[model samples]
Target: MLIDIKGVLNLWGSFVRFTDCKGYPTMQAFMRESPQEREKQRYLPRLDDDTLAKVDRQIRKLDPAGKAKAYLANLAKPNDKREELESLESDELQFAILYLRYVAGLENKPIWQKLSLSKGAFENELRLAERFVEGVLIGSEIRLFL
Candidate 1:
């Protein structure tokens, strides 16, 4: 009277497999974490000598707050809020900064508007802006991606 649970599930177009009924429902969940969760999580890759040095110069000239402000400002969109934060998540902020640095250009409106960050958050982001930017640049280089 044993059933081929895997075969039955497959026939029903539900392909999850588990040892028993007790493990059934949870097997199909998408909440499983990505593979990189256990390892040291690196957001960006290594930069070439020229790019690395250029980035150093850029970072050196900017105070933490200023860099954060600038990086965020570069990401703000047209007609974006002057004092509102963007919807970008914590992890996405690093990528957004790269877009700001290598992709988006400056315009007539203030940089904060484009970055869509409130003053307080922008200031807070500055404290770690350099690290975020470095991670993105380095990771992007390592992956041969932008």
Candidate 2:
């Protein structure tokens, strides 16, 4: 296929600019990181087995309804201003927190009962939480030894 040099150069230049602004060596290594470097780039804080188990248990205990209320109440709140539910390790934290609030209202003696969420909605939230936890576990395990 015929390629456009101008477009390619522009894209490369944009990538270099982005990396350079982030204090990285720009044009040379912006998006062409070597396989070895890519392997090295997955550095995250090491989470112990115990920590993993703890998070698993916490996720299992998450309250769906409470999560819904929290999600709604915090809708108008800034991303970082809300009360911390748990220290999310990655994107998993995002979904897991939302799941907790959704399940909260389902409990008979729920923490807060002001809002009512549909049963389907509550289940969907739980599913999302499950996916998040799965991702967190898999991501951590794959990168833990790296």
Candidate 3:
């Protein structure tokens, strides 16, 4: 079966939201801000103590990591694709997942710098990793043909 690229990208976005490590609201907030604004906000750090406590309480209630793992397991199903994802080289998988996760507002320069990847190389690797993830989702038969 042929997979729709736009559908996959949309699914990938939703998957990233589902697996959000930083809490969904926080991720959404970050997504809403521009990169420069995010950087400024990071430096300025504007949450009040009560708000911070409330956020902490919400985080404790949410258990995002457990929820994300459960969701990923369900998505992977019989294929054990989550295991395959985990088995990828640390940089490759981390970059791919993070790239997808922060698709809304993340800047590539910082990530490439952190990963010690040249711009062109990082882009190439990220593309390949995304393709791999798409294959994993579509299944072994499709992946083998690819």
Candidate 4:
């Protein structure tokens, strides 16, 4: 089957959100919402074991800091690349790491709250982060399992 890159990324985003929010009462209530309401939310796809293993390996090859720096560099045009790189916090990697962690069923509340992002904003960030990682992998000629 041809892979739906955007759909897979979106599903990963939802998986992150679900893992992050699952422990909270709010999330529980949301889950308990009517089937129609639940259906409105995005659902994660179930990949085969081999595909999942390959995806996980590809994901592990990512350098979070490098990815974050590249992402920031793209956003700032005609800027001092060295200065920008020097100023980057290791935490900047959290943008991608948090999403990956969420997919792994891990949650980091501090990072999630620190951004103070609305659901839509957070999802957008996750999408960008995923794109960055994908670009890095492809640029390096690494095959994406997804």
Taking all chains together, each candidate's TM-score versus the true structure is: 0.29, 0.28, 0.37, 0.34
Candidate 1 C-alpha lDDT tens digits along 1-146: 22332222122121111111233244557775333222222222332333334444443333333444444564454545455544655444533443343334333133345556665665455435545544544544422222
Residue 25, candidate 3: C-alpha displacement in angstroms: 12
Worst 10 residues of 3 by lDDT: 36-45
Candidate maximizing lDDT: 4
Q: By TM-score, is 1 or 2 better?
A: 1
lDDT of 4 at 40: 33
**Each candidate: RMSD:** 19.5, 18.7, 16.9, 12.9
Which regions of candidate 1 fall more than 4 Å away from where they truly are?
1-86, 107-109, 133-146
Better of 2 and 4 by lDDT: 4
Of 2 and 4, the candidate ranking higher by TM-score: 4
Q: Give the range of the ten consecutive residues with the poorest summed lDDT in model 1.
A: 12-21
C-alpha displacement of 1 in model 1, angstroms?
A: 69
Which one is best on TM-score? 3
- Return the lDDT, model 4, position 39: 25
> Clashing residue pairs, candidate 3?
none
Off by over 4 Å in 2: 1-49, 53-115, 142-146
Give the distance in Å from residue 60's predicted Cα in candidate 4 to where it truly belongs: 2.3
